[model samples]
Target chain A: MSGRPIFTRPARLAAIVPYVWMLLLFLVPFGFVLKISLSQSALSQPPYLPTFAIAMDDAAWRAALGLLSVDSFRLLLTDNLYVLSYLRSLVVALVSTALLLAIGYPIAYGMARLPLRWQPVAMMLVIVPFWTSFLIRIYAWITILQHDGLLNQVLLALRIVAEPVVWLSTDSAMYLGMIYSYLPFMILPLYATLSKMDPALLEAANDLGASPRRAFWSITLPLSLPGVAAGWLLCFIPITGEFVIPDLLAGSESSMIGQTLWLEFFTNKDWPVASAIAIVLLLVLLTPLAIYNRLQRRQLEAR
Target chain B: MRANRLSPFNIICLTLGAAFLYLPIVILVIYSFNASRLVTVWGGWSLRWYQDLFNDSAMLAAAWMSLRVGVASATLATLLGTLAAVALARGEGFRGRGAFSGMLYAPLVMPEVITGLSLLLLFVAVNAERGFWTVTAAHTTLTMCFVAVAVQSRLSALDRGLEEAAMDLGCTPTRAFIAVTLTLIWPAIAAGWMLAFTLSLDDVVIASFATGPGSATLPIRIYSEVRLGVKPQINAVCTLIIALITVLIVTASLVSKLSRARGESAAPL
Candidate 1:
């Protein structure tokens, strides 16, 4: 090793630069959200009361703190609309995650099983759509799911239905979009885990007389649990707050929490209520996120 | 052993999955050239929508804005992220390292709405105008974490001995890094920048929240137009974006492969 300390002046400066930037731009913003969540809605520019100013005196600070209340959160609990939206978001997240797993696991396993020379190409195919525009991908589905769109035309030609199915603006369309959009997120992690698995273990299982299916369950499935959890959290956490798919594809009957939050901020201009929804949503997702972080740490340590 | 072979069942799964993923996009591209006003009805293939898209000044302006923001933010994110990757990979036992790492990774999974809401609130509190710079700042913050992760992995995998050998030759630390480490990690840095740019261009939710008047990005504009109904112009725009992204990704991959092969051959004995 060179006769140099680890934390040189430039290295310390490098760490401080990103740390301060993240603290101000990333972490401190959450502080504002929390403060705004406690304040009351108003008719002013930002449409909230008790806005905290940094230059305020201690007396003013205490007064602003006094104005803070849990009423917005209380409203979320007591109101059927908000309560149903949260529950709906959770159900959608859970169900979509399961569907993604069902669809993605096999595809990932298939990609993992691809020949070495072709595996990178297969991985590229899976990642291409991921890098494309989210809105455009969703829009593509809209075109295909329209009343007189390709899906309907094919169905009509095949005599699958007498008329075009009411595909758009339904829960089914929404779920289809969810699975399509998030499939890559699920597949990537599963592929990472599955491809890393040693074939020797499977061969040993076979030598021990375990069938392929038995080997998959006893050896493969258990080994990929961390990936399963990671994929589930990746899909579930985002789907719970998904605004675009439900907004564009799902019907107006029942909305997810993300839609509710959007309406509260944009339509109603209820910043406090929107902030409360955000806080609660964050709290709800914190568990899975923490679990994911722990899993990642374990994975990194393992490596 | 049979374990290494690609089973027919697995091959079928891969084929079906690729079809499912790609068919929609393929259909979208085909319909963008449709001559008919109706999206579903394909009058003989024509460039009608693409023509219509070119004349739409609002759409063009939004695309320009998105491009500017994407470039600025991607550049900023890459710089800060490379610094961060360096700090994480090389700096040992710094103060608040845990929090530093947590803050770096949190935004990767943090909900877009929350991030947008918080950033907007931050702008409001600071009395800063929400326009080009605000959107750029928000995109930078959101994307730098991804860049950090990408670069960090590459950094960790790098052989530090090469950097050390350069130092032993009497090169200053910064010079050694520029002459040696930077050349090796260049591909990851490039990948990080591209990822940041693509994400910035594609984001709708965060842009919708953080943007003010006269600063609507392409995704925001497309989203609004799409919500009204399926316009043929939107299809043309989407096709263009998809084509651009495909080219960029392919070119980047090829370049990285070339660099990797060169690096392999140039390895010292």
Candidate 2:
């Protein structure tokens, strides 16, 4: 083993740079955010003045800690608008993930079962949508969903509606935009996992007199849980902080946590409040992510 | 099962999925030729929007800026990522390797808003003026992780024997790597560069935060335009971008496949 190639001293030192860079650049800023979240909001001055003990006493330190109490949490909870937005973001993410799963599963399964030569072609088609600007893709939904847009034009031509429907600035339109944007994310992972499954198991199930639906539910679906989890996590986590879809499709009336955070940071210039909001958002978003990681580890262990 | 036989279900799925993915693009392309200002109107076909898009200096400038930044960022990212991938793949059991990999993966999983906001704060704290440099820095930071992962996968799948054999033939380690490992993994590095370029081109949220007025990217410009209101010229731009990407993807895939086939034929049996 000693005679074999291993990491050279220089190579190991080089490897340490990226981690140090990440810690200084990525992790430190996050730490700063957490620190700011715990500090008192400098409403009277700049957003983060870093208050000190007025009398240089222990009571001042205690008071500073007291000021940073769960007031932000209380404010976030009591504000029905913020609470509603949080819930709405979750619902949108969940619904979008489900819709993507529904649409992506059949397409992925079909792609996986296709002739080997055509599989790459199918994958290319799925990934081509990603090549364009993401904002442009969301903007494409605006063209399709706006009043007197292409969808309405077709519907009117078909005599399905006497007038154009107001689809944009609605939650349904937001949902459609998000699912359309993220469907490829769902499909790719599902396709990757499903394609790796043993074909013999499916054949064995079929040979044992299981119908197509039964075979899919019993064998294919269970095995593809990891893919489902991965796809769901990919779609759900990002959509929680989605600003563009809600902004374009649902308008300000359906403002999401991301939009709110954007406004707080940029428009209001309230750094402490924004930091507090961001900290809470991080917690809310990371809970599911942590849970997903735990589940993935368990799944691996079980295997 | 016969090779040529196709299931009806598979056929339907393929058709529907392709249609769903491509219809918006087709619509955008077709409507770029619409004579009327209203994109929904079925007016006589013309190339007015494309002409308008070309004549618009701001759009051209934004596109140029995006191209410059994208190329710069992708180049930097590919280099950094290649080094990191080598470390992660070939430096097995090295000190702090797991932590390095985790850090590499963190940005990919983190929400863009968090990344953008965090970077914005960092830039502010450091007194670094937000502009082209900041935007390029932000893009490189995110794109490097993607490049690393792509290159690492290729490196992991590579046969170690070729490099070992080359080294055994009295070549220096670095020389053997260049002659064997690098030649074999060049395709992956190229793929990672293309992926990074595309990602940089598509970035908006982070670019919005880091970009100054003079360094607005095409996506940032397009985003501001959409926020104001959609215009047919935007469709013309989207159409051009889609066409460019399709050409690139086809070219890259064909070239990579040919190179791999050649490599397989030349490999020692």
Candidate 3:
């Protein structure tokens, strides 16, 4: 298999290069974060205790051995603020993902049902907005939702409300921002899967006296589950740690874990606590990631 | 089945969806030329904000840095990603392939906050001074995964027989790869590079953590000011960036369409 030793050896080496780079820069960094999570915060410049050194000092050794007081983690579990923020972030992400699905499925299905000549145009329309800067898009929402913003102006002129309803700093506004920003992420994959389906399947169901809605449910919905799952995962994971949306639209009262982590590091200057929160965040996401991997393996095997 | 028609319900959904996506951007772009300082007011059209944006030194510096960082990191990401994709797609079987694949995909799905915080800690642990390089390193790690996925899909869909045929014609393995395979995947590689560059340009959170003093990207700059309230100047800059991006995307689509018309075999990216 390797008669050409010159070519085989170098090609193998080239492959190994990226693996080593990822191991050093990607994998090893997580190890540092985990190590810092186990230590204590310091007032010194680098900010963390014994500076992630394990075998150097007795205190460092104790910290490395998990002998340090689990105070940071304890604070995380006991503090209602921290606990609620975690839960709220999860809830927001889940609800937003569901909203995206609800809003995006119809658009995707419409695109998929279009004639071949028109499908690409619909797909491009979905992607064009995504090319804009995310921060700018969120900023646009601020202008649209503020007290004297366009929405309020239009509503007042139309006699929808006597006074401008505050839409910028509310949970509903946050939900709107999330759905606006992430809808493309949800729609693209669903479009990918739905567009690939053979039209005859739906035609057969319709020919057999099933209404369009029933055919969609019985034939199309079940088939699009994989795309929905992928889009759901893509949206949920990033939205859970979403910083810009909540910071700009929802404000500080909305306690997403990402904001919480930022506060711990910058405002509180508690690097250890921030690291602890990060560790917990990673731990929380592990199950779903593993499950995703398992499903992917199964799909590959089925193929 | 062949004559599938979009019902009225589907048409409405599509129209509303398109409007929702485009309206904010349209408003933002239009307001950049507003003469009034107020964000929402329809001031008479003026180019004052665009003039101010051009003269702002801090913004000029941040834009330059962001451009340089995006280009440098995207180039690094594209090279590393291509190598990884080649291994994954071209290699028949390799040890630790599963774990390697998982490592590559983890960054794709991982939270940005966690990634930023983790990389910051790594820099501190290594006593590496956080600066331009630190941001570039973090970006390379973040974007390489995307490039790898793009290139890998292209490589997998490629005709495997071409490389074998080249090898059979007394060409060495590496020669076959360079002469046959690399040329075919060049388009995907270019697409991946542009994707990575834009991602680096648009990034804020990761740049916030991984960067040290004097490394604020354009997003960071805009975000800090946006908190005070929206300004016309910010809208001006946003329009310019969007314009640049539009040019890039239009060029990309035209290239792909032209290549397709020429009967080239590259997959749609």
Best by TM-score: 1
**What is the docking quality class of candidate 1?**
medium
Candidate 3 clashing pairs, residues 3+ apart or interchain: none
Error of 2 at B85 (Å): 1.5
**Top-down DockQ ranking:** 1, 3, 2
Candidate 1 per-residue C-alpha lDDT over B1-269 given as tens digits, one digit per residue, 9 for 90 to 100: 12348889999999999999999999999989888999998798889889888899999999999999999999999999999988877675568877787888778878788899999999998889988999999999999999998998897788777877888888888887788888999999999999999999999999888899988999999999999999788889999999989888988898899999999999854
- Minimal lDDT window, size 10, model 1 chain A: A1-10
Q: How good is the docking of model 3, by CAPRI class?
A: medium
Q: Rank candidates, lDDT, best first.
A: 1, 3, 2
Over 4 Å off, model 2 = A1-3, A7-11, A39-47, A51-74, A291-303, B1-6
Candidate 1: tens digits of C-alpha lDDT, residues A191-274: 988988988899899999999999999999999988898889888988999999999999999999999999999999999999
Candidates 1 and 3 compared by TM-score, better number: 1
- Superior candidate under lDDT, 1 versus 2: 1
* TM-score of predicted chain B versus true chain B for each candidate: 0.96, 0.94, 0.93
Scoring only chain A, what TM-score does candidate 2 earn? 0.86
Interface RMSD (Å), every candidate: 2.4, 3.1, 3.0
Model 2 agreement with the true structure over B120-152: per-residue lDDT tens digits: 767766668878888998898899888988888
TM-score of 3: 0.94
C-alpha lDDT of candidate 2 relative to the true structure? 0.79
